[model samples]
Target: MAPLSIQAPDDGTVLGQLPTDDAASIDAKVKAAARAMAGWVDAGPMRRAEVLLQIAADTKAALPELAEKLSKEQGKTRKEALMELDRYIGPFIQYAGLATAVGGRHHQLGGGVAGHVERGPVGVTAAIVPWNFPASLFGSKLAPALAAGCGFLIKPAETTPLITLRLAEIAQVHLPEGLLDVVIGGPDVGELLVEHPGVARVAFTGSTAVGRRIAARAGQGLKRVSLELGGCDPFVLLAGADTGAAARALMGTRFYNAGQVCVAPKRLIVQDAVADEMIDLLTTRINRVVPGPSLAPESTMGPLHTERGRAVLEEQIADAVDAGAELVGGGRPDGERTGRGWFVRPALLLDPPQGARVRTEETFGPVLSVVRVRDEDEAIAVANETPYGLGASVWSADRQRAWDVARRIPAGYTWINALGRVYDELPFGGVRASGMGREHGVEALESYLEDRTFIYPAASH
Candidate 1:
C-alpha cells in the first residue's frame, strides 16, 4: 500500500510519507509491548530513571535537528519549535527524579493484620498524541510511562509524524526493544490501538469529540485511559487591569502555534468599564503580528496545519462577521499572505454575538472574540459558560481579586495575569468536557499506575 503524504502548511509542499499500519501491525506491537514490560519492571525504578535521563540527554543533543523537523512537519517557526523540543526533555528529567518518590502506603489493620498498598504500571500502554505540540505532549506521556515501567506504542498524528519517527529511532538506540514504538496512521490505526485486547492503557491528547470515542472504547474493554482534550478557554480582563499587558498576554496565547492550541484563550471577557481600552490595545497589538510561513524568522504567526483547518476557521469568521461582530483588525487574509499557504490574519472581534460560532465554538484559529460584562460576577459567568473547562486567565491590578476570580472559574487550570503555559512540575488537565484524568507532575504518574493491596499478619510485616 502507498504511504500517506504529509503536506506542510507553510508552503503546501510534501514533507514526506508516513507508512500506514493495519490491525496486524497493531497486534504485533501490542504483543511486543507486553513482552517488553517484564524487562522494564525488572530494571526497577532507578534503572528506568537512568534510561529516561539518557533519553533526555539524547533529545537535547539533537535539539537543532529535531526542531527543524518539527517546524517542517508541524508548521511552527524554528524558534518556537526549538523551545518546544527543549521542553520535551523536561518531563523525562522530572519523572526520573520523581521515580523514587512514588512509594506505596502502609496501613495498620486491626486484629493483628497489616496492609500495604502498592502502585505499579499497566502493561502494553498506547499514547495517541495530536499534531500540535507533538513532542511536548508525547514527552508528558513517555516520561511518566517509563518512570512507572510501562511499555507504550506512540501513534503520532498523520499530519506530523516525522519528528516522532526520528525520536523513535533515538529511542531504539537508547532504550529496550519494544519499550518505545511509533506507529503512523490516521484515526483507524488509533482506534485499533485503543481497542486492542492486549493493550491495558490509553493516553490521548486531542479534541474532546475524539477523546470521548477513545474513552468509550477503552471503557468497554475496562482499560485505563487518560484524556487531555479540547478547550475554549477564557481570558478575563477585570476593571483597573493594565490594558497593554493584558493585550500582550492575550495576543501571545492566541498567536502561539497560530492559535491552534487546545488551551489557548478563545473568549476575551472584559469589564464594561474598561472594554474600549482593552479593545484598542488588542487591535493595535494584533495588527502588528505578521502572518507568514512558519520557517520565516520574522513571522510571528504561521499557517494553519491543514487546508480543512483554514476552511473551518473562515466559516466561523464569516458567521461572526455576519452576526454583527466588528472586525477591529483582522479576519481575512490579504496581500502576500493570500498566496498558497493556509494563512489567516490575527483577528480581533469586538462585541460578537454570544451565540456566534466564533464565540461559542473552539475556532482553533487566530481569532479573539471580546465580550463586555457588567461586573466581576458577570465576567465569571461568561468565563464558565463554555462546556470546556480546560484553562482560563484573569488579569487585574489587585492580585487578591485576580486569585479570587480565578478560583471561581470552573477550570482544571487557571492563570492570574498571565497566559497559559505547561510545566513538568505542575499538573495540567481539564474538567467538564475538556478531558478526564490529568498529565504532568505526580498526577500523571498516578494515571499510568494501578493500585494493589496486600494484607498479612502483623508479625509477617
Candidate 2:
C-alpha cells in the first residue's frame, strides 16, 4: 500500500503522507537489519562511536527539514517540533561517546578482586515506537541500541511514521545498509516485529495493554524485552504550597503534547488551602492556551492526533461530567473539521467522582482532572490509587515536606515543586502497570546489552 497522509489532531498541520511497507517489504527489511546488526555489533567501540557521531552531525543538519515534516505530519507546530528534534542530538552524541567508554569496566570485589564485568549487545533489536513523540521516542530507543552495537528494526505508529521513515534514510548515511529499517503498519506489524526470529530483544513504548501483549509474544520467543508504557502521573498541591507555583507547574505538566504524553499529569491532588485557588488559577491558564496546528509558532495546543483520539477524550469528559465532575472550562470540538483542523478546546474537570472518565481513564486529550483532599496521607492514598506509577510531582513550601511526599508517591520518578523532567544521565522507568525496565541513564546502554562475567584468577590477575 502507498504511504498515507493523516490529519493533525486539532488545528495542527498534516503529518505528511507516509509509505506503508507491505509484509514482504517488512520481511526484507528485518532480514537486512539482522544482517547489518551482526556485522555492526562485531565492530569495535570506536567504530560504532564514529558512526554515531556522524548520525548526530547529520541530525543537526537536517533539523529544519525534519522539524517541518514533523509539524506537517505529527500535528506539532514547527517550533515545538524543531525543539523536540533538537533534544535528540545531545542524547545521541552522549550515548555514542559511551559506546566504548561503557561495558564491563572491571569492578573490584572483596579479597584479591575479581576479573571484569562486561556488557555486550544481545543482537538484533526491534523498537516499536509511538506517535506522540515520534522522533524523540525513536531516537531515545535507537540511539542506545546503536551505542550498544545493536542493530534495530523499527515499526513506527501508523499515525506518525513520517519522521521514523525519514530518519531511516538519514541514519543509513552514517550506518551500513540496513543498519536501521523502519516499517509502517498497525498493531499487527508490531506483533511481527516482536516475534520475528531474528529479533533478540523488543523495546516498546506504548499503552499498558499493548505492552502486555508484546510481552507475551516476546516471552514466547524467549527474546529479551523492555517496555515503556502508559501513565496517569499525579500532581499534588500541598497546604503550604505557593498556589501560583503549583498552578503553573500543573498547566505545563497536564497540557504538554496536548496531554498525549504517557507520563503526563492525570490527576491533580490539592490540599484545602490551595485547592480552590489552584482550580481558579488553572482554569484561567487553561482558557488562555491558544489552539492551532502544532506547527504554528503561536500554537500552544493542537488537535488530538485523530478523530478517535478526540472521541475518547470527549467520552471521558462526558463520562466524568455525568459522574458529577464539574466541567470548569471549554467544551467539545465544534465539528469534525472545526477550527481550521482537528482542534479541541482545552478543558478542566474539577472534583470528578471516583468512577469518572477523567478520573479513571488516561484521557490523552486537552482535559485534566482536578480533585481535592484534606491532608498528605489522603493525598498519597489518592495518588497511589491508580494502576499507573510512571511519574508524579509534589508542591509545598517546605522543601523537606515536598521531598517527603514526592518520595512516598508510587512512581519511578518524582518531582518537588516542579513537573517531572528527565535527565539523560539518570534512569527513567515506571513501576506497576506503567511498564518495566529503565530507558535512560547508564542503564540505557545496558538495556540493549547482555552481561558476561569474566573471571581471571592469579593466572590472569
Candidate 3:
C-alpha cells in the first residue's frame, strides 16, 4: 500500500510521506510493546528516570529541526512551534523526578493482618494525539507513561505526524526497542489501537464527538481511557477590572494558535459597566494581528490546518452574521496578501444574538463573540450556558472577587485574572463533555497504572 502524503499547511507544499499501518502490523507492534514492558519493569526507577532524562536531552538537542518541521506541517508560527518545543523540557524533567512517586502503599489491619496496595503498569498504552500542539501534548502523555513503566505507542494525526515520528526516532535509541512506537494514519489506525485487546489504556486528545466513540470502544474492552477533548471556554471581565489589561489578555487568548486551542477563550462575557470600553481596547489589539504564512516572523497569527477547517469557521461566522451579529474587523482576507493558504481574518462579533452559531458552537478559529451582561450573576449564567466545561478565565480588580467568580464557573481549570498559561505541575483536563480523565502531574502517570491489593495473615508467618 502507498504511504500517506503530508502537506505543509502554509503553502500546500509536499513535506513527506508516512507509511500506513494495518491491523496485522498493529498487532505485531502491540506484541512488541507487551514484550518490552517486562524489560522496562526490571529496569528499576533510577534507570527509568535516566532514560526519560536522556530522551529530554535528545529532544533539546533537536529543538531547531523539530520546531521547523512542526511549523511546516502543523500550521503554527515558527515562534509558537519553538515555544512548544521548549515547553517539552518541563514534563520530561518533572516525570524523571517523579519516578519514586509511583509506588505502592501499606496499611495495617486490626486483626493481625496487613493490606498492601501495589501499583504496576497497565500493560501497553496507546497515545492518540491531535494535530494542534502535537509535541506538547505528546510529552503530556509520553513522559508520564514512561515513568509508570509502560510501553507507549503514538498514533499521531494524519496531517501532522512528521514531528512526532522524528521524536520517536530520536527517543527509541536511548530506550529499549519497541518501548516507543509511532504509527501514522487516519481514523482507521486509531480504531485498531483503541479496540486492540492488548492495549490496556488509551490516552486521547481531540474532538468530543470522536472522543465519545473512542471512550465507548475502550469501555467495551473494559480498558482505561484518558481523554482531553474540546472546549467552549469563557472569558469574563467584571465591573471593576482594568479594561485595558483584560482586553489585551482576552485578545491574546483568541489569537494564540489562531484561536484553534482547545482551551482558548471562546466566549467573552463582560459586565455592562465596562463592556463598551473593553470592546474598544480589544478591537485595537485585534486590528494589529496580521495573518500570514507560519514561517513569517511578522505574522501574529497563522492559517488553520486545512481548507475544511477554514470553511467550518466561515460557515459559523456567516451564520452568526446572518443572525444579527456585528462583524467588527478582519472577517475577510487581507487585500495585501495573496490567497494561497487556508487563512481567515481576526474577527470580533459585538452583541451577537443569543442563538448565534459563534456563541453556541466552538468556533476554533481567530474569532470571538463579545456579549455584555447585567452583573456578575448574569456573567456566570452566560458562561456556563455551553455544554463544554474545559477551561475559563475571570478578570477582576479584586483578587478575592475574581476567585469567587472563578469558583462559580463550571470548568476543570480556571485562571483568575490570567489567560493562556498552563503549568506542568498542575492537572490539565476538563469536566462534563470536555474529557474523561486528567492529564499532567502525578495523577497522569498513575492513570496508566493499575493497583492490586494483597492481605496476609500474621499467623502464617
Candidate 4:
C-alpha cells in the first residue's frame, strides 16, 4: 500500500509519511485487541487509572514538541495547539478518576429472589477520529473506552495522523502491548475497523454523511457505535442582551481554530433590537484576525487544515454573497503573508437567505452567517431550522428568558449566555442529523461497557 503523506497545511510542506494499514493489517490489530481485552479488564479500574495518569504526565512533559507538530499538520495556531493538548490531557485525568467509580447495583425482589447487576468491558473498541482537534477528540474517546476496560484501536485522520501517532506512542509505553494500537489511513482503513467482528464498538468523530455510513455498516454487524458529527450550531442573541459581550464570545468561539470546530457558532441569529450593534461589533472583531502560517507568532489565526476544506468554505461564502447576503468582513486573504497555506480571511455574511448554502450547510471555516429576526420566537424558530441539533447558545440579560429560549432550541447541548465551551463532566452529543450517542462525562465511559444481571435465590446468598 502507498504511504499516507502528512503535510503541513500552513505551506503544503510534506512533513512525514506513514505506512497505510490494509484490511489484513487492520484485521490483525482487531484480533490482537480481542486477545488483550481480558488482561486489560483484569488489570482493574485502579490499575487502569494509574496507567492513564502516568500517560497524562508523560504527555505533559512532551507538550512543546507535540503542540508544534499539531499546529503544523492541523493548521491551528500555536496557542490553539497547546490548548488542544491541554484539553487532551484533561480527559485522561477525568476518566482516571471516573474509572474507579464505575459500578453496578443490586436489586431486591420479592419471593426470595434477588438480582446483582454488573458492568463489563464491551471488548475491543475502534475510535475513528477526524483531523480537526484530533488529539483532544481522540483522547475523549480513548480515555473513556480504556477506563471502561475496553481494548482500544484508533484510526486517525490521514492528514493529521502524526500527532495522534506520537500520542499513541507516548501512551503505549504505559499500556499493555496490543491493548492500544493505531492504524494509519483514510476511509478504507476506517471501514475495515467498523466491519471487523472483533471490534465490539465503533466511536467516530467526523462529518454527518460519513457518520451515517459508519452507522449503517456497523449496524449490520450489531456493533455498538457512537457518532460525534457535523454541526451548524446557532448563536442566538435575544433583545436586551449585551451585544458587546455577545460579539466577543462570537469572535472567540466562531473564529477559534479558524472556525473548524464542530461546535462553533456557525449561525448567528440576533433579535432586531440588537442585530445592528451585534453585527457591527462582530465585524470589527473579525477584521482584526491575521491569517498566516500556523507556527508564526504574529498569525492571529491559521489556515484551513486542507485545500478541500478551504475550497468548500469559499464556495459557501460565494453562494451566500450571490444570494444577496452582505459580506461584511474578511474573505479569501491573498498575499505573501498567507504564502502557500490554505488560509481564508474570517468573514461575516449578514442576513443571507435561509436557503443559502452558508445558512443551510455546516460552514467549516472562519465564516459566520448572521440572521436577523423580529423577536425571541423567530430566534428559536430559526435556530432549529437546520437539520443539525448538535449545539446552540442563547444570550440575554434576563437569565430566565435566556434559559427559556435555550430550552426551546433542539440542540443536544445549549449554552445560556455562555461561549461554546464543552465541560468534560457533562454529557455532550447531538440530535437530528448531527449524529448520536454522547462523548463526555460518565455517559461516555458507560457507552464502552455492557451490563449483565445475575438473578438467583436470596437464600443462596
Candidate 5:
C-alpha cells in the first residue's frame, strides 16, 4: 500500500486508514478490554501506579522517534510537538501518584436515606481524539478513563493517528491487548465507535459542529460523552495594565500550535489608553516568530496541521482584510510559505466591523485579531460576546480588579496573571458552544465515573 498523505480539499488524499473489524472482532476487543480491566481495577493503587510508571518510562525511551514522527507527520514544530510528550507523561505520573488517594466521600445522612453514595467505573469507554494536540488530548482522555478502571477503543485523527496507534501497541504488552486498543482512522471509524452499543462512554475533542453530531449519536445510545470543542477565547487588557506583559501573553496564546489550539487567545481586547502601543508590540512579536517546515531548528512556529487548516485560515484572513480589518502583519503570501508545506504568516489584525466574520469565526491559524475598548466594561462585554466560553485571559496592574472582571466572563477557566494556558492537574472545560463537561485534573476522572446510591436504613426506620 502507498503511504498516506493528509491533504485538505485540494490535494485529495486520505491520511490514515483503519481496518474494518467485524462485529465479532469488535466484541472480542470489548470482551478482552473488560477482562483486562477487571484485573487492572483490582490491581490496587501501588500496582496500577507501577504499570503507569513503566508506560511513562517507555514513552521517554520512545520520545525521539515518537516526537519526531508525530511532529513531522502533523506539521507541528519540534518544540510544540515535544510538549505533547511532556503533557502525556506528566498526567500519567500525576494520576498514578494520586490513584491511592482518590475515592468517593461520605455524606451526612438525612430522612430515610441512611448511607452516602459511591462512584464506580461504567465499564468500557470509547475515546475519539482529534488531530490538534493529538497525543496530549489522547492522553487526557485515555489516562483518566483507564485510571478509573475503564477500558477504551481509540479513534485518532487522520492526520496524526500513528502515535496513538503506537501507544496502543506498547499497551499490548503492559495493557493486555484490548484493555487499550486503537482504531487508526478518522470520522467513518468514529461513527462506528460512537454508534456502537458496546462502547458505553465516549470522549471527543474537535469542532463544535462535529461535537453536536457526536452528542446526537452518543445520545441515541445513552452513552456518556465528554467533549472539548472549539474555543474563540478572548484576552483582555485594561488601561492600567502593562502593555508589554499583555503583548507577551498574547504572543504565547495566539501563536502557540500556530494558533490551531481550541483555547488559544483568538481575540486581543485592549483599553484605548494603550491600544496603539499594544497593537504595535503585538505586530513586532508576530513578525519576529518564524513559521516553516517542522524540523527547522530556528522555527518557533510551524506549518498548519493540514492543507485545509491553512486554506480555511487564509480565506478568513482575506475576508477580514476585505471587510476592512486592518492587517498589521499578515496578508502577503510569500513564495517560501506557498512552496513548501501548508504555512501562513502570523497575522495581527485590528477589530473591523461589528460581527465581522473574522471577528466571529475561530480562525485556528497563526492569526490574532485586535479589538479596542473604551474601558473595562466594554472589554468584558466584548470578551463575553462570543458564544464560546472555554477560557479567557485578563491582564491589569490591579490584580484584584482583573480577578473581579475575569469572574464576570462566561468562560470556565480564567487566568488573571497569565494567558489562556493549562496545567494538566486543573479542571478544564467550556460553558456554551465551547461544549459541556471538563477534562484533566481530579474532575476528569469523575466525569468518566457514575455515582450510585447505597441505602442501609436502620431496621426500626
Candidate 6:
C-alpha cells in the first residue's frame, strides 16, 4: 500500500509520511491486546495509575516538541497547539486519580444469601479519534480505558497521525507490550477495528453520519460503543444581556482552532433588542483576526485543516449570502498569505434566512451565523430548531432567566452566560442527531467497564 503523506495545512509542506495499516496488521494488534488483557487487568488500578502518571510526566517534558509537531500537522497556531497539549495532559492525571476509586457494592439478602456487584474492564477497546483535536481527544479515551483496566487500540486521523503516534510511543515505554497500540490509516482501518471480534468496545469522535455507521456495525456484533459526534451548538443572547461581553466571548469560542471545534457556538441567536449591537461588536472583532501560517508569531488564526474544509466553509457563506443574509465582516483574506494555504478570514453572517444551509448544517470553519428573534421565547425556539443537540448557551444579566432559558434548550449540555469552557468534572455529550454517549469526568471511565453480579450463599453461622 502507498504511504499516506502528512502535510502542513498552513503552507502545504510535506511534514512526513506514514504507511497505512491493513486488516492483517490491525488484526495482529487486536490479538495481541486480547492476549495481554488479563495481565493488564491483574496489575490492578494503582499500578495502572502509576503508569498513567509516568506517561503524563513524560508528555509534559516533551510538550514543546509535541506542540510544534501538532501545529504543523493540524493547522493551529503554536499557542493553540500548546493549549491543546495542556488539554491532553489533564485527562491522564484526572483518570489516574480516579483509578483506584473504581469499585463495586456488597449487598446482604435474606435466606443467608449475599450479593456483590462488581465492575470490571470490558476487554480490548478501540478508539477512533478525529483530526480537529487529536491529542486531547485521544487522551480523553486512552487515559480512561487504561485506568479502567482495558487494553486499548487507536486509529488516529490520517491527516494528523504524527502527534498521536508519538504520544503512543511515549506511553508504550510505561505500558505493557501490546497493551496499547495505534493503527494509522483512513476509514478502512477504522472499519477493520470496529468489526474485529477481538475488539470489545469502540469509542469514536467524528461526524454523526460515520458514527451511525459505526454504531450499526457494532450493534450487529453486540459490542459496546460510545460516540461523540457532530454539533451545531447555539449561543443565545437575551434582551438585557451585555452584547459587548457576549461578542467578545463569541470571537474566541466561534473562531478557536479556526472554528473546527465540534461544540463551538456555530449559531448566534440574539433577541431583537440587542441583535444590532451584538452584530456590530462581533463584526468589528471578526475583522481584526490575523489569518496566516500556524507558526507565525503575528497570526491570530491558522488555516482550515484541509482545502476541502475551507471550500466547504466558503460555500456555506455563499449559500447564506444568496439566501439574503448580510455578509457583515469576513471573506477570503486578501494578501500574499492567501495563495499558499487554506486560510479563510473568520466570517459573520447577519440574519441569515431560516432555511440557509449555515442554519441547518454544521459549518465546520470560522463562520458565525446570526439570527434575530423578537423575544426570549423565539430565541429558545430558534436555538432548539436544529437537528443537533450537542450544546447551547444562554446569556442574560438575570441569572434565573438565563438558567430557565438554558433548561428550555434540548441540547445535552447548556451554559449560562458562558461560551466554550468545558470542565473536566462535568460529563459532556450530545442528544438527538448530535450522537449519543458521554466523554470526560467519571462517566467516561465507566464507559470502558462492565458490571457483574456475583451472588453466593453464606456459610451457616
Candidate 3 structure quality by residue, lDDT tens digits, 1-461: 57999988777889998789999999999989999989999998889999889989989998888988899899899998998887766788999999866789888886899888999988899999989888899888999898989998999999988989888888889888888898778998899888999999899999999999999999999999998999888999899998877777877677788888998898889999998888888888888888888988788788898888989998988888899888888565655442778888888888888888777688888888999999889999999888889999999999998999899988999988775688888889999989978998888988978899999985663
TM-score of each: 0.96, 0.92, 0.97, 0.98, 0.91, 0.98
Candidate numbers sorted by lDDT from highest down: 4, 6, 3, 1, 2, 5
Q: How many clashes does each candidate structure show, in the order listed?
A: 0, 20, 0, 0, 0, 0
Model 3 spans with C-alpha error above 4 angstroms: 335-338, 459-461
Best by lDDT: 4
lDDT value for model 6: 0.90
Q: Model 2, 1-461: lDDT tens per residue?
A: 65566656555455466667666777787788878877786788898988888988998999888988787777766766876797677678878778877657675565665667677888888899888888888888888899888888888888887678787788888887887888778887788778778789898999999999999999999998888888888888888778887777777767877777888788988887778878889888988887776655676776677777777787888888888888877665454345656567878888897877566567787787888999999999889888888889888899998888888888888888775677778888889998899887878888788888876663456
> Model 6, range 1-461, lDDT digits (tens) per residue?
89999988987899998899998998899999888878988899999999899999999999989989999999999999999999898989999999999999988887899888999999899999999999999998999999998899999999999999999999999888999999989988899889999899999999999999999989888998888888888898889887777887888788999999999999999888888888888878887889998988999999999999888888889999999998876667778876788988888888898889988799999899999999889988888778899988889999999998889898878888875778777899999998888999999999999999988986632
lDDT of all predictions: 0.86, 0.80, 0.87, 0.90, 0.78, 0.90
Measured by TM-score, how close is model 1 to the native structure?
A: 0.96
lDDT by residue (87-174, candidate 4, tens digit) is 9999999999999999999888989999999999988999999999999999999999989989999999999889998999999999
Of candidates 5 and 3, the better by TM-score: 3
- Alpha-carbon RMSD to native, per candidate: 1.6, 2.8, 1.4, 1.1, 3.1, 1.2
Higher-scoring candidate on lDDT, 3 or 4: 4
The ten-residue window of minimal lDDT in model 6 covers 452-461
As a whole number from 0 to 100, the lDDT of residue 419 in candidate 4 is 65
Q: Return the TM-score for candidate 3, rounded to 2 decimals.
A: 0.97
Instruction: Give candidate 1 misplaced runs (Cα > 4 Å).
Output: 331-338
Return the number of clashes found in candidate 1: 0
Pick by lDDT: 1 or 4, better one? 4
How well does candidate 1 match the true structure, expressed as C-alpha RMSD? 1.6
Per-residue C-alpha lDDT of model 1 across residues 130-153, encoded as one tens digit per residue:
998989888889889889988989
